[model samples]
Target: MRDVAREAGVALRTVSRVVNGESNVNAEMAGRVHSTIARLGYRPDERARQLRRGSSQTIGAALRGTGGMWEHTAEHTARAAGFMTLAASTEDDPALYAQVIESLCQRRVDGLMVEPIGAATPYLVAEVEAGLPVVAVDRPLEDVPADSVVSDNAGGIRAAVEHLLARGHREIAYIGDSERIYTGRLRAEAFRSCLQEAGLAVEDASVTTGEAGPEMVADALDRMRRCSAPPTALVTGNNVISWQVLRQLGPAIGELAVFCFDSLENAELLAHPVSTVNQDLEGLGRTAVDLLLARLAEPERERQHIILPVSLSIRASSEVPPPPRARRRRAHKAQAPSS
Candidate 1:
């Protein structure tokens, strides 16, 4: 700080204010300090300063995939509050997740917003204990007592199921991502609950959950088709599953009732537009940033777990009613004879 101030011909306090992201420094002096900083290859001691003061004016984001709208919204919100966002994708790997978080901590980012995957992160809990402000987004960190913002997975599944049931579909099948994922597990459980509440037996074949792959989906569909009473409706666990199922079904998309758990853009352009339960991505992102900021402001506040509400977007696909019972039976019988 002293060296930069001397080079820029400014007071040490002015250099401190500029380096710490404090407001009210003169624009010209601040500019000169920044120019000196650039010329001298000077970098502030962020970790030491963060220990005395409370911030690095930067946030580290550990996201599940490539930073999308969720990351963009979070970045924008944080920037508005004078924080820069640094992000890295976990790619759904535990080793990668751990490495990313550790690397961010080393950079002394003021806080973290993570889209958790894989398993419980006790490593993250240690950071929180040491005064790192952390917020979970999309999914909560298992066993970590951090504020989280996520969608109502159960509610979304309920909406889809009720819509199909109202459309006269008794048998519904589901294809989901791996049960290891938080969203996939919650959604699968929700689907079973919906069926049981409606007085329907839970058929193991009616739901297939594992890591999503075309082979797994095709086999699940084949098994459902072979049921004594085949499903007339399908509720996919997420947008990826919905599209995978659609790709396999091809021309059959319009014939079967389908409800996807996530929103699809330009869905109306399809032969049969998919109905969806929309998760507010922007809201989730912004809320996560706000929560992290609040945490930074008052580190002693009680932790909050927020579940944002979801809305249904009905389209052509889910409105398709169940095939008539006679036709269903005949189709089964005809296939049986050939087999």
Candidate 2:
């Protein structure tokens, strides 16, 4: 502080105010202080200051994927609220999840917002009891108590099913993530229910899940098409599965009505504009931060779970019906006698 004050030709208190981003510091003085700090390669001792104040004013985020828009949005929202943010990817690994959470706790962050990867987190119970506010995003923590923000997975599946059904699609197959995952399970189950309600068969080969490689997705498509009654439409569980399915389906993609549970980045630009059940990612990110901050302010507040709605964005792919030739081929194959 003293070095910065001397270099910027300002009092130590002025340097402190500028470093803390206090409104009382004039713009010109603050600029000078920032420039001097940059030239001197001086970084604030945030930990030491936090210890003195008994508040770290920082938030940690544990996300499912390696990196994406969710992490960026959450970090930006927290920073805008005057809080420092740190993030790590769990990659759906239980050990990694524990390690990341422990590291963040060691740093004494004010709270955490995590896209939970596994079923149980009994370890987090003690941490929450110790006054660390934890908010779960995308999926809720089963073993530990925490606030949560999630898109309506079941509702999204219902919307997708409705969209395809309205387009006269009866035989709709699904390719999804492993049902062991929360989001995947909800979506797959919802799809099955929708089919059953419409008196359509949920063929074993028509609803495939577990892995999402190109080969795996291609195999699912082949299985559905090879069946005695091929599906005329399809629904994908999430963005990763959706993209792979689209790639594997290729020129044949337009032959079937397709709806994905989650929206993709370049969906609108695809050769066949992909219809999707769109989750409000930005809203989910902002809500997680707001929930964590609220819990921090009132430690005694009840645990909250926010489920945002999803909407279907129609496009060329989902609204289209099966090609006449494709339908005829399937009908003739079904009617043919066994050799």
Candidate 3:
């Protein structure tokens, strides 16, 4: 307290007033003291006890977007539980994520909710062990054994493939995000397994993955279309890729059977009623908050890894039969060897 007061050029009582949430201190002075406290990594010795006892009553949420639906739902739930939510965006950058987390830590937040982006997070190991309740949303922490909430990636992909297969899509092509991402890799792998189970071969033209940019998606579509055994149906990895493939297909979107893995807005309103696999974003938020609050209430409880289910909606886009010309090509080529 004395060090903070000395550095902020404020009296000791003012620092105490700021920390204790007492009034009469100027807002500017309070802000300065807060900054100094974060810079000095100042934490009260018994913050663990204070937070568990509901003394500080604040938790930090580090996500991709602070105003997203998941974040908003979480804030509402936390407020209902008598806890204030402090949210920040990670911008999917590792360094920025670290800084935001550090600031949250300096403020001595009771818990943390994060939509992890980076490949690994080593700095969180010590914090978790020190009685900090951390809940990972969407993706699990690479280096820590903390509670996490994630969607069923493999199951969602399987549902998409199964739905397409039942509709007579023998040669189905998949275009999705780069395999470097966790969901991307898992979905791609699941698509391959689906092919093998159906006694179909997995080939490059059948599975394309790269950065999810407009040009990249367009190029992938072109390559798949040019192949000798081009796909009669297409399955996109996520919502963004699904939209890109739709745009790239243009008038041809009506020609190919399409199935999208992640959720898409107004899917039935399109030229062809597009099939989709939708994740429960609201459920994810609610479950994550419930898990975090449970951990806060019982710090010694076992960590939980919860996987929510996804639903697949079948529509005209994916329910259509394979193009006759493409099916004929496959049959003719198969008989050519004996001929």
Candidate 4:
């Protein structure tokens, strides 16, 4: 900054104003200061600027779990964007979520990005109503008015179902999350609609919804197999459930086609690579930042819900053939000819 001031022929205060984006300097002086700073490769101290401007230079993110793959990726993305992330998980509990939100608000974070635990918490609704800049990531708050960035769950699930149908799979099963989250509900609805459109009925016994633990997924798979007519293809709601199902199915994965909402990190290593509806994690993180920044810039703008498109990754897991039918018996006319 001193070098920039000297090069621009301006006082230290004038250079500071230009760098902080404060008004008062003439256009020509501002341009000179910017040019000098660029040429000298001088970068402002963001921490100092935050302290001087009363900004935190920090953002709070509420994740589902610390060990989860998605949360780790989100944290890396946030750090790469030059923002400090204060992360907390609610374990899908509303009370825990409320407590976390209160703590983040008391700390006065510049903004917040959250994957809401349930439908819509009263605390979250109040926060948005109070003009806080909040961005919903992955799972949206249904009743709360806030900027949201989420993958196209419905479209992605529909594509998966269609792919299975194209492979001659008439009996398809679905395993999803607890319908408490918006993404789960959307994907489940899409699965049903796609099956109906294809003139196939979604049997109640074939659909399973619950926690995504390994034991739970194993039980669900067992139930599906016990059905009078088992499904030849299955669509999992998200990554966790997909892994659980895969572990239980093991080598027999080829017998039942599979599709999932989100892709795993080492998806290629599977015996039969599982197909997935891939979400751009980096893009989603950047988009959440963009929304929060926009809200910070203009608070009175209308709330926006930005839906990012999900791409279908076709793989061997979704390539199973339909079940074979019983062959008809040959006529017994040979006995008469012999007589």
Q: Which numbered prediction scores highest in TM-score against the true structure?
A: 1
Question: Model 4: per-residue lDDT, tens digit, 1-339?
Answer: 888889899999999999887899999999999989889999999778878987786788877666554556556665776568888887778788888888898777888988887745777767777778999888677777888888888989988998888888888999998776677788888888998998988788667887678877887887776666677789999888998888888898988889888987778777799899998776687788878878988999988888888898888888878666321012222222453
What are the per-residue Cα lDDT tens digits for candidate 2 across 1-339? 899999999999999888877899888999999999999999999777787679888998877774666667788889998898888878778898888888888888899988887657777888998989999999888778899999999999998898788778777899998888888888889999999998988889889988667887888987887777778889999888999988888898887888988888888998899999999888888899999889978999899999999888889989887556576576759756699
Cα lDDT, model 4, residue 73: 59
lDDT of 3 by residue, 201-309 (tens): 9988899998888998988887786777778888899888999888878888887888898777888898787889988988888888899899988999988999999
Better of 2 and 3 by lDDT: 2
Model 4 segments more than 4 A misplaced: 1-54, 66-83, 327-339
Q: Model 1 over residues 40-88: C-alpha lDDT tens digits?
A: 9999886787787756789999988875788899999999998999999
Descending-TM-score candidate ranking: 1, 2, 3, 4
**What ordering of candidates by lDDT runs from best to worst?**
1, 2, 3, 4
In model 1, which runs have C-alpha deviations exceeding 4 angstroms? Answer: 1-54
lDDT of 1 at 204: 85
lDDT of 2: 0.86
lDDT of 1 at 93: 87
lDDT computed for candidate 4: 0.81
Best lDDT among the predictions, by candidate number? 1
Error of 4 at 290 (Å): 0.2
Please report, in order, the local distance difference test score of every candidate based on alpha carbons.
0.90, 0.86, 0.85, 0.81
Backbone clash total for model 2 is: 0
Candidate 1 weakest lDDT stretch, 10 residues: 46-55
Off by over 4 Å in 3: 1-54, 325-339
